[model samples]
Target: MPSGRRGRATWLGVLGIGLIVALLAVAWLQVRQAALLRQAVEVADDDAVLLVYQAETEYLRLRDEWSRSSDPRRVLDAPALQLRYDIWVSRVGLLHNERIGNALATDTGFAETLQRIDRFIRRADAVFAAPDGPGPTRVALQELEPELMSLGAEIHGLSLRAAHRVGEQIAARNATVQSHNLVGIGLTVSLSALTLAFALLALRQMRQLDRRRAALEDLAEHLRSARRDAEAASEAKSAFLANMSHEIRTPFHGLLGMLSLLRDTGLNQQQVGYLRTAAESADHLLAILNDILDMSQLESGRMVLSPAPVELRALLRDVEALMRPQAHAKALALHIGTDPALPERVLCDATRVKQVLFNLLSNAIKFSDHGAIVLDVQARDNEAMAELVFVVSDQGIGIDEATLGTLFRRFAQGDSSRSRRHGGTGLGLEISRNLARLMGGDITVTSKPGEGSSFSFRMPLRPVQAVPAPRTLPGDAPPPPRPLRVLIAEDHVVNRQYMAALLERLGHDAVFATNGREAVEAMRAAEGKPFDIVLMDLHMPEMDGIAATRAIRALPDAAAATVPIVALTADAFTETRDRCLVAGMNDFLTKPVSPPKLAASLRRFFGSTGGADFAPEPAAPEPAAAGGESPPLVDTAAVALALQAMPRERLAAMVHSFLDQGPQLVQRLRAAVRDAQPLELRVNAHAARGAALNLGLAALAATAETLHEGASHLPAHEIARHVQRFADLLPATRAAAIAAGLPLPAGAAV
Candidate 1:
């Protein structure tokens, strides 16, 4: 097409050049011809006729002079007469001038007259010759007189004829000039016409160019529109997926909870096995749902990472424990190895990292029927960054080359036929890869036909100075142990039943509210009843957990306002957790809750009073000295940990400071309860609780936690009783501090 355009342009150039050259050539020729005609007119209009007139007049004057001389009575001076004759003869000779010659050439009579004049001059010149040659005499003068006189008429006639011929020549030259002017005018008009045509063609070509430019702009606009349309569709798809995920998972969580409850119901062995399998299938389906939701979040750029310092070794240990059962179920060996060079704590989103690892390990286990799957961790350094590399290698039915290619692509499975046998949504790997990238890491796989596949996740590892101690395993430090009056606020029947069964097993009295509204009403109606905790389901119909919590806190009766509120929901989003916290809820729990987790929540609120299952091992009773001295109330180890959290002087100040303000805090709590301001009571109680805990005042801290928890729901009289108890303990706590050897401020006393 470009060549064709160039060819067209070349033709236009040739045609334009050719036309201009033709016009220029015509103009140049006309100018040259006109210049020639002008030159001819100038030549034809020369002074020949004027010269002829002068010569003829001189002839007449000579004849008159000679005729006068012919008077015999006059004393004719020969020399003087001869002088006049010679002058006349000179005039006659000038007839031979070029202009005169050309003028007379076309005049037959003018030439003859010029010849007659020349003869007369010749004859008369003999008398006017030099003294040595001749002298003018009377007879000679008389003879020449008649001839000179006759020649006068002839010369006059010749002059008249020359003037007429000059007029005709001037007329002819004017006609020739008119012809050249006409030719020049015609050539100029033709040139103007061609110029107008060329301009019109150029103008038309410019319009076409403008049209093409507009077309290109339109095409660009169309592409932008198409891109925008595609983006909108993608955004819509993301929204739909998020909504659908929430809807499906909410009920799905209830189903899982029901399954947990069903297991407790005594049943036949076959029924138990079927139920377990059904539960596992449901769990798998939920997992697939989660994977789909993750993919949607990632594809829409809605996923966010919250990174914190994580203990790498502990994280691997947790991974091993979780994967061991599945490995054992399949009779496969699972090995996890960590290099000594790895950092104790690295900055990462621990949950997401675990998730990616879990996905990879799960796939490894599922694909491998019997062989071992090994997870190895090590520190790797590149030019730009340091990384923690985790490699999960499996030996079993090896992945084929073709299957490995799409292993990480969304909705892609290795073998179509095996998808049913090993069901999955096929988005796990894709989600894992996206998550890795979000945290400045990547997941890659290498596999060969009939050989093992190795999947590696590498993340940029940032070391942290404050390495948190290894997390205390469950049972090593049991959950908060305590049973208490519990309020279950849930809308789903199955979920409510599950909570009932679980709460009954935990040896706690349980009351029910169908939704947030009923829950609030139940608390209000309790009328100082001892409801230890409120499990507020977030997705209730009448009012959500946040709103209900707010309403409860604002209740006029302080006892009914400051109840311990725990948000329960199926939402696993960070935003939802934040919403729960921001709404004045004391704790948050994701649904499909286990007995241990529920017990933990209860223990967190009721502490030692709740039960031993969740209670921290009681601080050993202070031992008496060797001499049977009084025992110290404070633990030295707990005090040392406190000192590490603050300077010794600050710790002492805080301990003394809390004792000094103890009375005032108690008074405020009482006043808040009397005034029905649960927020104020909760705040004061929370402050006291924190300070008391920090100072190792276990009894005071425990009392404050109760006040903080029950300020709204515990009766005003009961709250006052707790307050009086708190005041009485101050003196005892001071005595214990002195016994523990902690120095008191000056002027302070037990």
Candidate 2:
């Protein structure tokens, strides 16, 4: 319960307890008063006065009887005279009763009057005792009558005194009762007022509670509305970013292609220098664009890490290779080191890790004109988990506390003046930190003005067993001795012209198709001499590359159906690549493609490579590891060998066909497990393993191999688990294949 309500309930309980106690006290007081009133009434019963009056009347009757006996005219009624005497004595005795005596005790004459009556009763009893013997009771009765008559006056006086005393007592009791009634009335009024106040307080509390409840509900609704608005705004931002990426990259590709073509136009020395500057600016712009796209992906939670076992030394070597040129240009020393205890192989996403290191080193080289930049790698144990720490310390103009606070904020730099001198998007550090955090790590910086800066990047240490590097096809081999036929599909006129010129320079026969549909038609019509390879553009008016590839793969003629279809697009999203591959495209190449990149792709498909004069593409840095239990999705080396042995289109068909059978394979595996048929499970697993191995679906192949090996002795549930793992790998393998350009080279799986 809420604290306010809980406190109110406790307060109410205390009030209720107090009210009950007050009521009990009032009841007790009322009961006590009632008992006192009853005792007063019992004490003032007027019984003493009644007894005294009866004695006086009996005295008068006795006196009369005695007078008659003394007259001697009525023949002396002895029995009647004796009865009167006895009755008088009895009445007088009643006056002597303890209750009556106590009531009359306050009167001084009461005791004397009772004594005199006792004397008369004693004398009369003697005469009445002899009633059955003689009639000598007349003289005795006459004697007792005189005393009894005299006692009447005393008895009357006692009665008067007793009545006066009772009256006084009754008056006093009335006064007491009146006072008690007043006190009871006052108490009752106070209690009523107290009860009314409590009721009012309770009512007010209820009203407050109702108001609070309404306020809380309103606040909750406002928060919910705010959350909805935020979500909508976030979705809009993501959409805008995606659209901008596609729009900008599509045009940017043509611009870069034209620049590259212009560079080789036999220019003078001054023109060549201008071209170099322009190329540098273009490269910088491209870097900024890539950073923006990466930031967007991070914000939208779409940046996925592809982790695998990587050689630690090889990865560091790649970083050094990329940064050494920049460092040398600035005349700065770059030193990279690692602890001896560090493992040879660690799991991580090599590309992102390299991206971060590259940014840090580049910044160091950019800022420092003198001194050295040091990058040290070490393993540190933190409680239960081990961590791999990379510290990049640079002898550059450092940052102040004020600038350090916002250093990792987007678009924020160390110093405004220095930031102008060193041009950047100011998103590199932020992107690096985000990437680090995404990999269960963080990047922290320590800097002091006029000194230097040290950036420490830490991530969980996960060691993996080192495996022998896969053998790759030779890159130094001579190019094709003869020219080959190549088809280009594109909608943009500039891009189509650029491609035609690039092919002509490479000494290859080039055929042009305006769109994907035209490309498919061209392939179908090429019965006499089919095209060697088709370079397909992804976006076109008539048909997209994905659809066209699917159409070509479904052709009736075997040779036409097995034509290699390579997707060339400006969109670099992983999802787009996966779609192209799943539609049976042989490979994917992001646009702004240089001559060397094109030459390399051609050399892989056909055994023709004569573009050796062009500069080679830079070797990509090894990615760091992400946490996963399965092997890599695709074995690039295997795929390369497969492409060498068979046509590219045939391998794509085999890969697609294998992926299509995922559901059926899952069903068969399930049935085998359900029926406890190990042989059937083994047969199915073996079949899957063979196909996956041929297609270079490494994760699927590994899963299938596990099932095939364990089917005989493994528990049913364990076998089922492996089958489920196999099922899950199908889509991931397809996506990985696409991201890695489908038929990738050795160690090129994404």
Candidate 3:
């Protein structure tokens, strides 16, 4: 039973036992009172007055016998007279009993009267016992009669007093019995009252129990209804995000394509500038859309993680590479420390792990005013397994306990004021925590206001065997003698055209397929002359790349089925890539595809005998500027490589196109600053840097890199200065291009 019910039972049982015992005591008391009253009545009936009365009767009889003897004719037989005297004397002796004696103890004559009677009996007995103990004579009888008669009167008086005393005692006993009856009545009334009270208490307790049960039932119903509503809402939100993602991405591809194609069109620097700004804004929107898609996938439980052996030092380098620029921009120190005991290779989802670390480091840089952000990696040996812990501590404006509770919540920021200064989707921490939990780990934070916050991420450490050394690029190499035939499967017309131009420049034969269905048909038609590779787009009409890859694999032609298939799409989600891989694709790539990235993908599948590692290594740092004069703005090596790849006319066209677009890009930079769209500014700067690097526009790339580095935090004035530097670099870039023998548009400054 419940404790509450058990307690109630105990109290009720005790009360009932007490009532029974009280009743038993009352019964015993009544029995004792009856016994006492009976004893008192017996005592009242045992009065000495009765014996005194008997004695008086005997005395009267003796007196009559003496009178008869005195008459002589009545011839008193002396023996009979003596017998009557003796009988009277015997009756007098009986008066000496304790009851009679006590009744007259206070009367002085009571003892004297007893003595007088006894003396008379003795004298009469002496006379009657002469010779043969004859009866009392008339003279002796007269003397004894006087004494006996006087004693009779005294005895009668003593009996009257005894009767009065007995009457008082009986009266007192009767009063006691009346008091006992009153007490019994009171006890009965009290027991009735107590029983009634006990019943009322029990009824009240039952009523309370009923009320509590009803409340609990109502609460349960409310919870059930709330759960149903939450599930329905979650489903609705998932559907909405999916629909939005699909709807936005379709046209977004076209927008991206249009922006890329616009670069080749002839236009003034200002017009080119507008186009670059639009492209950057589009990229920012795409990034935000990607974040939302990820959140949706996570919420709907569709996100998948692929774990592999990852090197700790190499992964840290990757993180530092991405974070170093942001830290440099703020002049904030970024320190990464790892315990010596940390394993060189541990099993983890490298990409997801990097994503979480990047998010944490990014937030630290955003919030900290001047203090350092420290990332410490260590391994803890738990009984079951080792746990790898990553502690990211930042001396930022610390979060209060009140705000800490909501820190990892989606769309929640530490403080409302910070939200304006440091903008974000606020899904980073939530995503990180969820990912950590999915990997059999958790994320926790410790912080105090005005101090700093330390976020610790701990995941089970499953180590793997060391991997062999990674492949390195051959230094200053040329392209291979053989140029492979590549098939391009793309649904976007502009993208297809761009790919064709790029392939043509690279000295390769290009086969085109507008959709997955045609791409599959093209391979089938190739017959024995199979294509070297299939660059498949994930999203397409008439069969998506994943399905096409599956179809090709199912083909009976082993050569065709085994052809290298690299997924090409704008979708950056790991789940999308994983699905393609599961469908039997060889590789994945995100779009607005770059030459180096494309080359790397190709090198991964095909041997790189021609130009291994096409990316330019960062040049050695020159001495600090002499007389504060800026160094040369462009790197000639990339221009030389471009010339080697294609005609100078083609290289010139690309450079001129980039120069013409510089002014517009700078204008967009200014506008983003004015609108306080830091993320937009960052995207624009990043794109500018990438494109500049492609054409070897070194100074412009440097300026864009600076702008990108500071976009999220730089003051408006500082950002404006960077924007001006970009605008000034346009004419400088055109002159540099001309100095390096690259083409420029008509009426260009050079």
Candidate 4:
């Protein structure tokens, strides 16, 4: 038992023992007192003394009456004489009582006196038996009086003896009561002392408890203060990290951009090799920066996963595409396979999954010189949930058990020798494991010295139905057809120059704005000749990209208000992307934007035929009679092609954006039809048809096609009917696209 409880139990036992002893003392006192009281009651002297004294007094009275009866002077008073005799006999009978007799028995003369009195009374009863029987009653009375008078001395002696014996017994009882009182007082004092000691013990215990409680309160306060200090320190660190990331990446993007531009400068063979080596080093530095950022986000609990329905095979293919080149350079074999039970599509964060696989595969390739690296995927049943497991095995420098224990720890590498040979930030495995755990899974490794290592990553399996493949833009297969007028909003001069050079190389005109204010002013100044697109930088002075985009969206001119604005910032955070999109930007592109990435973003808005230069005067749409079949609700083939160019989420957003604009298109078509302006009607229908075709909304595109084909020759009522039909097809097309496994953006209305 705990010491405190044991001490309490000991105190309780002592108290119980004291209580029992006190109770026993009280009982003994009570018994002694009761015995004294009983002794007093038994030895009462009043009855014995009174009985003997009365007997003597009656003897005197009888003797006097007898003397009178014997004398001639009293006449013959027989009745009076008999009464006195009877009184004397009755008094004598009382003296014979057992209580009085026993009390006086200590005097040996008591019994004899009682017996004589009884004998004399019996003799007197004969005379008194018949009141009228004799005239010689005087003689009878005279005889009884002598005997009664003789017995008086004996009775008087018995009275004195009873008084003496009772006095002795009373004295003895008083002594016993006094002794019991003394013992009871001593017992009471002992019990009171014991009770006081118990009270003192209880008071001491209470004081000790109070001290413990105060100490605990102080400790708790210290813990709370420490926690607050730690939190403040952590916040400061996170702030420093974010600020440094921005400061570093802003220049880093320019460096990478210049490197990209340097490639086109017609260099000799040796210069080209030097350029390639510098670019590789730059890429390696960028990778380290990304690892640091990832680690910081993971530590601060800010890394969020964007899980969606991803095609399993496509994700694996993407990993293979990036890793195969590294493997070929090392002269090592790379094999990737999946179990037949694996689902075709599953719900997961494709980007994070690919990142983890990339890290594992890169490590394998880095360590091994010639042996094969295998990535095998399998499915397993874990109780009620299904699990997907990825195993990466490499014939590399295997780790020992001692090193394996610290393998996944932060900044821990395989060994000191290997760490020196192959330098790294040593955060890739840690970051990968953290991401796996965030997704409700974990990563584990098994290795033996001089043998290969196998690392396994497992996560929950959430299968989803297959979605239609995204349609590919013509830019994926061909170059741009025409140059676009591009607006650049940036604060840094180097970034602005890099963007200008990049756009010029893509055969496009470039306009520069130093900040958001200047960008908005540039849009307003364009007036009749608006720029084809706006490339917004988020962290510019005076006003940021979000505010500038919002301001430009509020423009009175329709062309300026509707121009596509893409965020081009160094901030790669998800919240930044969401803020840009919510502020009405068309798309988001992170820092260090490559030529191919920029080109792809442009192709998303303007197809291969190119910018607004070709949009205003579109070719007339063919009539429905040219094709007998009606258009389907959604074109799965076109959507499949788009998937090759961009992600499904990006395509879904575009579809939703186009649908949200349906009401505006319907209003414009109605106005054109009401005014009977074929030119206006054709322009609106052509724009809608182009947007619908790009997003694979076949039915809406077909309806717009009809309106465009009939705009000139058809009646106003026919154009109005086509416009109404176009309006009716919007809701159905959205539902068809969503049913085809393109999820709507978060928090979007159904």
Ten residues in sequence with the least summed lDDT for candidate 2: 741-750
State the TM-score for model 2.
0.29
Report lDDT (Cα) of residue 615, candidate 4: 13
Candidate 4 accuracy as TM-score: 0.29
Write one digit per residue (lDDT tens) for candidate 1, span 252-311. 999999999999999976588678767866775686577676565677788778899888
Q: What's the TM for model 1?
A: 0.29
Name the best candidate (by lDDT): 4
Model 3 has an lDDT value of 0.73
lDDT of 3 by residue, 198-268 (tens): 68778978888987997898899999999999999988987888778888888998999989998899986
lDDT of 1: 0.72
| Model 2 alpha-carbon miss at residue 471, Å | 18
lDDT of 4: 0.75
- Give the runs in model 2 whose Cα sits over 4 Å from its true position: 1-240, 251-291, 468-750
Candidate 2's clash total is 12
What's the CA RMSD for each of the models? 51.1, 46.6, 52.5, 48.2
